[model samples]
Target: MERIVCLLIFIIFNVVAQDEFIFWAELSNKNFILHHQNETISMAMTKSKNKTLEYACEITYVQNDFKEKMYDDFGVIAEEKMTKLDKFNFLNIHKNDLIDCFFNSKIDVKDFVKSEQTYVQSETYVRILPLRFVVEFHDNSAFIYYLK
Candidate 1:
């Protein structure tokens, strides 16, 4: 009788394990899209701005021209098909990330840090973050953020 009871318990445990399922969160670039689960969170379109170590372009989804035409020496349409164009690329400057904005004319990190300006050399790739500073990338481009 004991042996029969043990076999029944083992079968029940195996069935319960088989019925269990797992869920996961989707990761793209620097964003995490989550769904409602016991161990996960649901992500929305507005949550794409969550702060993460990774970075990606937000405007990477552009469609190509769906129609194309070919011309011969006689200026006649030969073929029609889809065509693609070059993708646009831009820099993303977060509040914690370091940026080069040509804040100095000496091109020295020490000298720029000593001054009370929030500018740096655009050609240099440094990882120094300033405290509460503004960066003007172009004539009408200016942004303010904090350090890490």
Candidate 2:
């Protein structure tokens, strides 16, 4: 009976592992941050402007806090944050320079948020706007986006 139970457990573990492996392996690599998230890292990208490479990252683990407000205000919008990031520190770095910084430096979740909320959880985002400079080489189109 014990042997049978152990076999069942092993089968269950194998199935779960296979599902996880498939989920991560099948994701698109067009975006680096998303690609990393699949490897057990949590991150998100925000809007970028034309010819600019700067993107915003969400550091909080709390999802969907502003959903109702977004739908009521903008009509069925996606994730929106009540917090506004300080532009002075992050934006002082130019788009191209920022991308270089992200590649070289290790990012922390606190780097993106304005407040310290213990229960809210946290995430990190690496700005990928500088990638736009290389997009033409990859045959990519210009995309405009605004995060809610």
- Cα lDDT tens digits for candidate 2, 1-148: 9999999876666444221110011122222243443222111122223433333322221233233433334453322222122121122223333233344323333233334565333344543221211110011111211221
Please give the CA lDDT of all the candidate structures.
0.24, 0.28
Clashes of each: 3, 6
TM-score of 2: 0.16
Show where candidate 1 strays beyond 4 Å.
Answer: 19-148
* Cα RMSD of predicted structure 1: 21.1
Could you say which candidate leads in TM-score? Answer: 2
